[model samples]
Target: MAKRATVADVAALAKVSSATVSNVIGNRSGKVSTRTRQRVLEAISALNYTYNENAATLRSNKSNIIGLVIHDLSNPYYTELIAKINRQLAKKGYATILACSDENLESQQSYLHLMQRHNALAVLLCPTWDTSGEHLAAWHDLSPTITFLRPVGSHESDFIGIDNYQAAYDLTRQLIADGHRQLAFIGGSQSSRLRRQRLQGWKDAHEDAGISWNDAHILYCSSSMSAGSAAVMQLFQQTSDVTALVCYQDIVAFGAMNALHYMGKTVGGEIAVTGFDGLSDAEGWLPSLTTAEVQIAVLAEHIVDRLLARLEKPQEPPSVTLLHAHIHWRASSHGDVDSSHAR
Candidate 1:
């Protein structure tokens, strides 16, 4: 059996230093002379050499693999986000290792550990509801991490996410302008920071409008269609005064819309419904959903650029970025006002 080709063999065959061979193979900027690169290429072609990424990672303690750990993959929001980030990473010559934590804190930690073992370049996380500052500290200790959507409690690292509070405020104010006096917030648990940010925005809107709000109006449930439908029944059971709903997710809004139909109630006319994460499906439904569009392409660009920049400039100070989501005021949230908000 023939021994496998290594960088050492390539360097020896090409009469160049091993570092020169590595620079040529890695396409290191302005490092390898063209003459030397040509020689290394010829030697590699002659030997049929294949660079071993795993071995290179072991030696340099750096990897071209990026980690994506999200709390829920069941939500289309996360699925689409994964797709966008994966595409962006692939374009930059990095591979993505995705893990769904199912919103479990323990599972999330386990995946972070797995990524650390693989020496992942960095981990982009949508933190679990119960994720704490200590968790962020420990994970940061292990690898470069950027938390998104729901920022971690601890000021452990950088974050890039939509401006949940502002977007919710804008949406809620719009609902108020449309004459929705009684509004309900549905989906997501109390433990989620992102949910709290959104809820605060909703509550502040009511306060600013001189309208009374209460805790009963905030429904805590899993971010799913079933939970959404159940939340509607649960809200009506408590009091049917809720004139509108502000869902934690678009999926939940979809469920609420379905539930409203089953209850023989008109969705937009009787009880306006609004959703977060302006998913593509939200735009094409029978009554197009009014939602805060997260703009996946823009978010993915931020995530990937942050990751690549971190790899190149590890010493730079970490920062948090928040971009406002575009509000699509469609027929679903059609209230008393003239529907000027585009579908």
Candidate 2:
């Protein structure tokens, strides 16, 4: 097998010192002559040499690596957001180190430690359910961070996420306008702030319309397609007057739709369904889902922008940016209003 090329080989071919070569490769060649930089570049191409990023980071005490930690990678909404973030970071010559916490606090803490040990540039965290304000404050001491999606208990870091209350309120009002008085909420535990925010939105819509909300109609379940489907079946076994279901996520809505099909119920006809997060799968489902479309690419850009700004000026006060989600009306919910809100 042939041995791989190294920086030394490039330097030998270019007839320049190793330091000059490092300067050229690391984009610190402002002092070096352009002629010498061209020669080093030509030699690098000729020798097919690639810089060892790890070694470079150790020498300069800097990194082009960012950590991206999320609760669940299986959710398309998060994976799509990750892809957008990766694209934006790559443009700045940074790489992403992804970690899935699976909603486990211990696993998230371990990943934070790993990021610190690697001297990562920054972290874009979508924290788990059990993550507390103290954990975020302690982790920030180790490395700069930007939180998204799920809110940390305290405001210690830059935060970017959808306006859950506003989006859910808009969705619930659309359902109410469509003559859906008997409404149910599916997915997410009662302990979740996100769930509570959405539930409050549902109540807000009911109150605005002079309709009394029923606690019995609210269902608590895991944020999974299977769990959603099972929840629907279970709901029907006890009662059968639910005219609409406002799901916690697109995946959960998909599950409920599956259960409805199995139960010989007509979606968008007898029972309306709505979902959060306009994942790509939602559009292609049998009956296209009526969902709140989060601006993922825009959100990713803001996350990267905030992290880079913090990296440049760490002493600046932490801030929060809550982006709006637009409701996409479709056959699933038989909704006709097209609008959005930011708060």
RMSD, each candidate, Å? 3.5, 4.2
Looking at candidate 1, the ten consecutive residues that score lowest on lDDT are: 334-343
Over 4 Å off in model 2, which ranges? Answer: 1-9, 29-33, 335-343
Q: What residue pairs clash in candidate 2, if any at all? A: none
Off by over 4 Å in 1: 8-20, 29-39, 335-343
Give each model a TM-score: 0.89, 0.92
Candidate 1: TM-score?
A: 0.89
Instruction: Output the number of the TM-score-best candidate.
Output: 2
Please write out the lDDT profile of model 2 over residues 216-285, one tens digit for every residue. 8888888789999999999889788788899998999999999999999889877789999888888899
Residue lDDT tens for model 1, 1-343: 8999998999999999999998999899799888889999999999999989888899888888989999888888888988999998898898989999988899999999999888888899988878887887876876789888777766667789889999999999888888877889999887778888999999999899888887898898888899999998888889977788999999999999998988887888888999999899998976899999879989988988888787787778888889889999899988553243221
The alpha-carbon deviation from the true structure for residue 136 of candidate 2, after best TM-score superposition, in angstroms, is 2.1
